[model samples]
Target chain A: MTGSPRPARLMDGTALARRLTDETTAAATALHRRTGTTPCLATVLVGEDPASVTYVRMKRNRCAQAGIRSRHLALPAATSTARLVDAIGELSADPDVHGILLQHPVGPHLDERAAFEAIAPAKDVDGVTTHSFAAMGFGLPGFVSCTPGGIMRLLDEYRVELSGKHAVVVGRSAILGKPAGLLLLGRDATVTYCHSRTRDLPSLLREADVLVAAVGKPDFIRGEHLKPGAVVIDAGYNPGNTGDVHFASARERAGLITPVPGGVGPMTIAVLLAQTVRAATRQLGLD
Target chain B: MTGSPRPARLMDGTALARRLTDETTAAATALHRRTGTTPCLATVLVGEDPASVTYVRMKRNRCAQAGIRSRHLALPAATSTARLVDAIGELSADPDVHGILLQHPVGPHLDERAAFEAIAPAKDVDGVTTHSFAAMGFGLPGFVSCTPGGIMRLLDEYRVELSGKHAVVVGRSAILGKPAGLLLLGRDATVTYCHSRTRDLPSLLREADVLVAAVGKPDFIRGEHLKPGAVVIDAGYNPGNTGDVHFASARERAGLITPVPGGVGPMTIAVLLAQTVRAATRQLGLD
Candidate 1:
């Protein structure tokens, strides 16, 4: 029989997210009690895409459970970029809406960056704007892009030593990969930003002490490409609940790994709700 | 001489900057003729730091030679953040000022970021603002920090292949290293950001196809740590007219290298002057 390697330690993002949400709930209650104003998260969905609809509804339900008010606007798929921007702008201008979440992939035709920019920086709970990006890049105090922000929380919860470690980010998407790399770099990790244009993926992957699998292709990275004992954070969630990393193989090679369904998904919601409360606290001058 | 290594091909930033300035001169002249408006650069210096004074004077002289107007504002060393911000804001609002340049290291007492943020995005020729950094990170249209912008031009002039190349940026200063890395990433180069906390410097150095030395330490990176035939662009300008790269040793190992005095320094001023013309063109509706 071949020698068996120790199975990777699983990062329990679900448990951490639940604890985080509980803390957020307490904060939300205290905030409401002090101001007598509910922290409202207004989610704007530009299209009727089934996936986006489910995501928005799930977030709204989570918000309700956390004592935060939820407001939903579902627009038709054919909504113009200008109209979508206008709708988000209106929500941004509304004093009652403490935070705004615009479901991404608004449509292929829509200029998503332009629409995201329309969300006021103060109300950008999802943290998808250039302002937030700038804040993350500058290492300044401001909102972070939600998915990556959750990734950081998971890393912290797991006690992964980031400083002086080599973190290879395997995507450069605006909301996820880019911000994740910046946040990691800000924490003093030597960060390599690899994307579709990167040459020799295996070479970089093999050297990554912490590999952020965020390319969005299901099971794109295999164990063969990974360094043994690498901390693997898979940010991919597909229709079948699969991840960007080959989970079974990755578990064999990685020292730590995050499961697809239970890992990053819940953390995203937790960070969003937390940021909403923080935004409310700031906007209401209760900070 | 049997084992003599081939000397590196020098990257002549001086010639490139001169050629760029000539082009800028023509554009500035054309703009003045068409709109009867001279491209004006307002140089705001807080405290008479000697090096800053010399740098500002050099820029003002370049503006004069290139047919662009320059306005100098010298604030006292005791200037508060609010006063400095207000002064920059006034120049930003002034239609006569086509661009604004805030001489950096205003003093130890000031918040440089807050002061840099005061420069309006439209007239930010120096590109030290968060807006410019975001633009670079997003690959969006906006001016870049002068030194990094110059670095790109030199890279382009030398026809260095950025796509898929591994670029190692050896600093993370807000104005220089961070923007430089972002620009390199936007060009499709796999970028690794190494800072003071980076461990095993030689390992990362050996993999760098293009090395950007911007750590502001004289001879911080040496030849022995370098990959043979790497293109080295040193951005450090020390008091003795030296650079971050140990030149003699770097030339022995590098395929191409920038000479200290002529390398990144002149290119920076050239980019600044060129951006001044652009800001003028856009503001005057000559674009």
Candidate 2:
């Protein structure tokens, strides 16, 4: 109430997501009619991490709504790296499975990279593999990480002029922060990556035309750190269902902003379902 | 006489390269004594382009100097993509060959990415494959693109603190400019990539704390565009042996600069040789 008179335009992820899913549903139905093949996604989740379980359940629900098939593999917490690789390898070899999604933070004991490599590049719809990452980094055609891909789709929906703009990404995780920066770089944005090791985060944040807060800390990016009229993308999903940005304060100064529950969250599953359809089409030689 | 009274100190590529090669030579010797297998590098050139021939020859010469064996395969310019891929596939399967280097810009017709993919990931010493690129992008354990690898080495050797520093890269070639920016981002630099479509290049150049001029156009980056006391890296090797930077004027303002002939040129081959030794040791179980 104490800030700018004109509040920022909210980037409505829910409405945009509904439109995206309508298109995806039509595509899936058409593909099923022509090829007599339902787009199938194989999801592998290690351990019953409550958060991961809920995430996977949400994805499964989204897939069902989109007319895509979901096959879930629930592995125990004590599974070895070799066993996880074998499980993923089996899915990668299955012609019926068009896409593979492996839940992350799968126990500290497993070698994540090795397990990711086991999934065929073609079946990497979740975009967690290094092959997918390399393709994304090089701006080549490949699956992209779901959350980052969602962020890009949202930006595109808003008709954001990314070129020549300074995009400050406040994280460096391989999946979210890194790929997001690379994707922005591919689109001609001057991308700056700041991590825990980065000095003077607020000073750098103030220079951004587009600020992406991927650091998974609630209310980490304050309104004062942002440049006035900056486009704010909150990718962080921390405890208490809050995002990385302090929404109330940030909304006053931002030109555009995404709400926590209704923003980046919905678009992620939308991308996953869409990519799965693409994977099925390509694999079935129908595209 | 027309420049600043104190020119920027040259980051001596020749001397640093010598130290690197000396270390590689010792490692090669130790590996040979342990496994009785000398490191072997396979150089493939697909055309009679004078530049390609010279580059392959230079790489082979350096391999010999380090006591590493060299194998050369010269193919006709008219060779089909399939034939080129087959040739590379054979080398990738050859147990005696520790590393592979393919001379780029084979022709306008052939698919470069396909040929690069033919090289086994483990033996991609030149780091041209998508696998290598992904590894470099993800900050994983794998070989980097030679020139970019060398640039990182030079930066590390000079103890250039990249964290939170603005690094402006003036190109976006798949192998050179793109990888260079990713490497700087990996080291926590705020990276900006400028290309032909980039608007207001001069304005962006002024903000750079570390500027990499990989644009092939000589004198493209004028002295007035550079920031005072900036670290300037000239990676261009254009016609007339001139760099992308206008050395005469830019050196006056820069605190550290790499000259055209003796700068980034020598470090490329040095990294290639070093990676070949690593490949040999890893493949031979001598690590």
Candidate 3:
């Protein structure tokens, strides 16, 4: 291992998100001017998860900035699956709502999948539906989940070639890890997904030319596990704004590393807004 | 390694499939008696791929024996995407055709994804549609792809516990490799997908508790790569009925191994018939 300190090139999501939001705002304005109706996103949150509430608020604020209308539905934590499904169904049936974003980890007892499924595929701008996941996995055209979509966009923006690259995704959660791996595969990268119980995670991580750490463990991936000149994307959003990677050690070894605070975090809302405008455009047959 | 020769336990897919077909036959009979409509599967094929033809024939024979109706759609090799889409759309819209199976590798030029997408999710018996793929990946209730479904059935038939196992799937093809890994992930297995450009493929194979060799290369996986006592499933069927895993060497090292000709092949047809009945039952609301 080189003891030399290599300056890691940062992937600035905040700047890229600003650019994306500008494009989305223009698209939303165009749609509104042509159709006399603004693109609308319905944000549904169950219970009072501080994180969920904060995420929805951020999304709504971004929506307003992008010239998209925001419709908020805050349900009680103890809401039943049937009632939640009914509400989502109603929103799906509403013509004004072009997109729907159901905040993740709805509650302890609610069936999150059933609730997400209720959102019509056309209006599933958050890309949490099974339809979206399948489309992503199969390399079919569909809205991608915000975080993973953000990661891919960053890779594309940096001109990091994905074809035949060994991408080791250190997480396997449905929305994050699995979808991330599938998206990498869609770009022709040979993706290997590692999870909590995966034996020899370090060994697999070392083989990656592109390593995506989404396992939510702060500083779980150290410098030694990184392949020399590997592009590292830390998608973990832990408390205190910590990342999954040990950045100090990783930056010394990595060719590229995304910082915790300004990296992948900002891109989520940007993609959400971008997809909202897309959904509106497609619904109105503008595209 | 133990020098003693252990007699290979046969993975009797034919017998297991027969048993499953018998059970399905009874279910179909019951449904027919109650609803007066036999479950039907529409098999669509483009061009005359000899292997695919044989596969479809086998499925139809099995369906007939199980008292299920078969609807066949055969298009010429030069069939346009629009015509093929139209044919599939017709089948998808047919109320009598409860399930749809579009035999794969339609043509090099044809957009297979578009063709597969034409089948409605409700009648996607073979589970090739994006909706079924997402459903499987998310651990939701949906039809599974026949080959992967058959592989799971074979594992269950032999009492192979998947949870917490290190499963190395050596392929990433849309239907087989990709879905196989997702199915394993759904079962809580730590799944790693290796493909054509995957570096150190053999080394990854050496670490697997369960190894699924789905890459089409004949005898690609050698015995040296086999982890001792690994449950090996060779889903590859090459010319002359060869498998991707070198069975002679793998058999020496593996605790259990599925023979290429008999292991996963029969299970595919069995699963198709079973899922056809399932799709029929679900669509008819008879279950």
Best by TM-score: 1
User: Second chain of candidate 3: TM-score?
Assistant: 0.96
* Lowest summed lDDT window (length 10), candidate 1 chain A: A1-10
Per-candidate count of clashing residue pairs (backbone under 3 Å): 0, 0, 0
Candidate 2 lDDT over A1-287, as tens digits, reads 24456778899989888899889999999999998999999999999999999989988999999999999999999999999999999999999999999989889999988899999999999889988888888788999998899999999999989998889898878889988988988898877777887666788798888999999999999888888888999999999989999998899888899999899988888888999999999999977
Query: Candidate 3 chain A, which ten residues in sequence have the lowest lDDT sum?
Result: A1-10
User: Tens-digit lDDT track for model 2 on B158-217?
Assistant: 888998788989888888988898888888787777787676678779888899988899
- Candidate 1: the clashing residue pairs are none
What are the C-alpha RMSDs, in order, of all predicted structures? Answer: 1.7, 2.5, 2.6
DockQ: which candidate is best? 1
lDDT of 1 by residue, B151-196 (tens): 9999999999999999999999889999999999999999999999
Q: What does candidate 3's lDDT look like per residue over B51-106, in tens digits?
A: 99997888898899999999898899999999999899999998999999999889
* Candidate closer to the true structure by TM-score (higher is better), 1 or 2: 1
CA shift of B98, model 2, Å: 1.7
**DockQ of each two-chain model:** 0.88, 0.55, 0.58
TM agreement with the true structure for every prediction:
0.98, 0.94, 0.92
